[model samples]
Target: MQGAQRNSLRLLQWMMAASLALPIALFVFTSTISYTSTKDIADREIERTLDVAHEHALKVFETIDRSLAELNEVVRGLPDEIIRSREPALHRRLKRLTDALPQLKSAWIFDANGKSLVNSLASPPQDLSFADRDYFYAHVDQNIGTFVGAALTPRPPYQGARFFGMSRRRETDDGSFIGVIQASVLPEYFESFYARIGSDPGSFFAMGRTDGVVLTHFPRLDRDFRLDPTGPVGQQIAAHPEHGLITIAWPSDGIERRVGYRRVAEYPIYVSAGLETSAIRARWLATMGQHLVFGIPATALLFLLLALAFRRTQHLHAEATARREAEEALKHSQRLEALGQLTGGVAHDFNNLLTVIRASVDLLNRPQLSEERRQRYINAIADAVARAAKLTSQLLAFARRQTLKPEVFDVGERMQSLHDMLATLLGPAIEIGIRLPAQPCLVKADAGQFETALINMATNARDAMQGKGRITFAVQAAATIPDTLVHVSGSHDLAGGDGLVSVAVSDTGIGIPAARLGRIFEPFFTTKQVGQGTGLGLSQVFGFARQSGGEVTVESEVGQGSTFSLYLPRVPTDLLPQRQAPNTAPAVAGSGMSVLLVEDNIELANFAADGLTELGYSITLVDNATDALAELTMDAERFDVVFSDVVMPGMTGLDLAQAIRDRGIRVPIVLTTGYSQALSQDGAAGFDLVQKPYSIEELSRVLHRAARLRPVRDGAAE
Candidate 1:
């Protein structure tokens, strides 16, 4: 009987080993197969992603082409004489064309002579004399009905920005070649399209021209990665343009990822999609785990029954662990992706507000102003200008555009300066209250930006209450977010040990609706009526807080008004000196300097010339830079100053200045334009700039300043 028991035990051991070995081998084999399958699935998904990107890109291109075609058709219908002679009618048509297509940065028609007849933008070049331009020679043929030009940096009349061009030939009724109607699409429009491509956090999409010039990339990678296409991954893509997938170690994240790519058949563009290998592995593991979850118990039961026949529990545990890890990774990727989108939207809107404010302030410094009214105007202008500057600093902070400029300052004192202004801004209906710490609570921040952000928030609160509710500006230091925030009532939590400084603005107005509350910080998305708001207020607050290594939170109910809290990182530091106010405007007395004023706007030009003449300066007016240059060449020292519109026909103001300088004509040049920022970053160096919509006194002041600063030789000649 003992020998029988021993034999049975040996048999059981053998059965268990056999069952375990077979299933263990099978699990390994199955997991390997699953990994392979997941890789294949990922490749297919990436291919689909590329196809969608291409389709969307083509749609964008087609829409632009259609708009260009319609514009060309309109120009083609007009009589040759009307098209050539009627500048007003042509301007109206061009304006309509551009207004209908905001994505088009600028549109213009070049006559057979290469002269720009009409332009959507201010002051286009008048002469087609420059033979080097693509449109100049291309339009001379007039046989090309429609053609997409190479990616080229646009010149004046086309906004002098980087743009992709679409051009079509315009002809007379007799089929005679007339000119070319060209449209330059802005880069922002393309960037917007790229933004929509890859929604997944682990996924990145890039589109590059056949020449390997990257047109756009989603979730913009580092600039170095964008610039050097000759890197390992770029080399791989260059070697294989057809549909393919390859595993590569991504330098940015230090992770191995599978990149899939496809080149559009007829277009010189390639679309590439990148997916993290770990993500794919995780997905496969989760799927395999789900199967193992159901298969495990059944397999165990089978082992129990088979143990009489075989015996073992194998395979399940290892598979389950891998699957769980994969599921966790996917969840993490999704969370990060959602967060990125939220931050990106906030940044984009904040930038737009900065753009508007910067442009608006630059327009305020025009030369013409009477001494009597200058101080009052200058004071009001300075207030507006300061607000604009603060807006940009906040954006830079939010975008992490610059290093933090932290300083210790009393929030109470800062709020005091703006108390009266806020009251006036909110109007008589809204009651304002300020709550401050008894002892000055020192906090760190770029003082100017911090103050601006506070003012912006208070202004928004007042607006929300519709000028009828009570608004409170409160500040304190806290170790923790107070639970009883509602009843805090101007309390300060001192000795909280270096915590954040909390600035809260609360209003007793109608609360934000739940749906729109999430998007209040998006640029150009205002709840206010058109023209009343640019929809950047909350966005600035949000960006400023984040940029300062701080956070902003909002809470609101349907009926109760909303409260916005900004928690700025605090530190002990000395406060910076306050900004001193500039004195009232200097006297505007024009020196009897002869000025050559070149402008294309006939009425505006005449008005400006009249205004300048009234200011005691002799003015020589020309419709375009060509005639101005002609008159200047006729007499080098003919004028003390050359004032030209930056955007004009034949030669742009910048080009005209260059030409004059080339001839060693050092007449002090002043370039003026409504769209000054779009011209050039440095502007016309060595020359002064005066933005448009200038009053007579402002013009005289510019002339006076220019005359005063003239070179010794030029001043002696004048």
Candidate 2:
């Protein structure tokens, strides 16, 4: 049955994949064909456009040819004397022809001796000699068909208009040359005509004679336009002769163009038109786009539908099983990896702290140590021990199984105490704000976790803003449960109240993006650059909140900044067991005072007791708090001070102190621990507290201050 089900799931997946992919594949294949067809159509259209323009260009040549042919007819019929008479009717007819063809600048009749006959002008300005002109000189044996001169600017009739002069030799009936009839064609006429036709900006239309002598062109109206017959485009035209289409890099702009050239059989002129390749490609893409616009989305929707169906039917079961296996493997691996890194980071910091302690302790052993130097070393040791204790405190705060000690305390007062430390932590660039409640807003949470979370948030805010921004720590109590928190949780340990305490850390800094907000609390996931972060800070905060039966939520907008709010259950301050004020009295002499020391580590107990004994105190060492309690119970007045480690297998030092006080004993109990959430509270604060790995001097001072001095062990007290 399982095998059949798995086969069905596999078939469903395959069917879904085929559902989306088959059509897309078909579209791709058909689209390729469609695109190719469109491109071909574009090429043909481009060719047709070039051909039409080329035909238009050739028509201009035909007009000039007809005009020349009419002039030939006049020369063949009219006698030299009649034409030379410069008859008004004949001159008007010549001017009418010139006016009809805008390309023709003028038509003139010049005798073989270069004397003007009928120059087509209503009035002659000056006598222009054309005896030196190429057309007049080309008359060889009276057999020259038609002569086209190079570009020239003639006087009067032609004015300053540049054109190629077309001339035909005039002869008498005996086949003797008589005069020359010439017409001027200004290229500007072609330039103006081609401008109205739709073509690419860089495209050109040209009319030239068979001998590679260009007569006129659309562009470069200021000069002659010609093409070399041996060039690629010219060769293509020459090879085809009647009409030719070839793509080539046009010489004028060096852009590839599809050139269409047609040779005019009636007029010894070839008309060539050029269209840029870029214009053709643009047309092709536009055509291809029309087909793809609808096809792509249809494919995507099919894909989405198939994915949803697969996820609903078969993927959920497989995924859940695979996810469980992967999560288990990944969790075990990540725990080991993160633990290793945490251990290394902790050890490195501890090494520095340990070095200070070691150096101070080694120096204190010097026989010739100065009193001032000795004091400095002792101070150094104490400072190192305090720093090391805080480091461990951070570690314990993040420990997975460490039971949180939830207590009710004023949130504002707690934050106010950390203000200076936070300021130093964030640096001078960041401003700190404390928006505390007017009245005490007591919340049930591990105070140490609260402090860590606050510090972590401030640090993150500082980093987000690159150390320059405002961070506000605010606390408030609510009268009702937040509507946003929809579910009532079973682990909700907030002091049974109408609402929870909201402790917020807001910063005017760079905010988190919505997509990354959810994963920010995941361990070993950080946006910070390598070597800049351990990635456990936010995870620790998250763990603290959940473990304490509270919840942390954040609100942020990019550029506007971010706010992290921790909601803890509120409790009445009056309900908390009141603690005595901390003892701040100065240290007294420990000389000859009897001290009972309880430490689980036998070596540590021996060392500490020996130092206390050497300091002129009677020392009684015990391995556990139970033993010390029994000893104290037996003879409570014998010892002046009870110094014990806060952590043990059973009956912690704090428990012993509570037990001692509960039993009506008045022994000044001094406890030593690296870090204990229990000892970090209001009740424990009244007892003299000292961090472990302390030098003899620190130990002496705390014990002296904590001592409820009885008669000296030597029995010499006044």
Best by TM-score: 2
Best by lDDT: 2
lDDT of 1 by residue, 1-718 (tens): 3355456557766766656666667778998998899888888888888788667666666776777777776776775567667766667777777787766777777776656777776543365442355644666665755555544665554345466566777777777776777877665565566566666546766666655556555555444224247877667767876666788876555678887777765555667777788888888889889878866776676667766542222233345556767987987886576456546644654566556556545545656755655565556555555554454444444444533345667676777778888887788988888998776666666676676678778888877887788999888876666563432112333332467778889899788887876667644457788457655567667666665656677778778998888776556534535756954575464557788999999999999888777767788888988899899889957688888898876678889998988988778888877553335334356677775556677777777778778777734634
Clashes of 1: 19
Q: Please, what are the lDDT tens digits per residue for candidate 2 over residues 1-718?
A: 4576577778878877787779778877876786678557655765676667667756766677677778767767576577756556667888899888877887777777776677566544246677877767776347567666767666555457677777777777778887777787776676676666645555666667777777666565554556778988678767888877777886655678766777765666777776667766665566667666886687777878877877786766677668878988998897787677677777777788899999899999989999999999999987887777656555555553344556777888898899899989999999888888898887777787788888888888888888898989888887644655422122344544546778888888878887888667765567899768756677677767766657777888899998887777777778665877966554344679889989999888888887777778998888988899899889987888899898898788888988998998778888887657665434365677776656677788888866744334455467
TM-score (all chains, Cα) for each model: 0.34, 0.44
Model 1 C-alpha lDDT versus the unseen true structure: 0.69
Model 1, 293: alpha-carbon shift in Å? 33
Candidate 1 ranges beyond 4 A from true positions? 1-415, 434-459, 466-468, 473-505, 518-560, 563-587, 630-634, 655-665, 676-687, 714-718
| Candidate 2: 10-residue stretch with minimal lDDT | 485-494
- Model 2 CA deviation exceeding 4 Å by range: 1-322, 355-380, 400-408, 413-425, 444-452, 479-498, 513-549, 557-560, 573-582, 590-594, 614-616, 624-718
Q: Cα deviation in Å at residue 266, candidate 2?
A: 99
Q: What is the lDDT of candidate 2?
A: 0.74
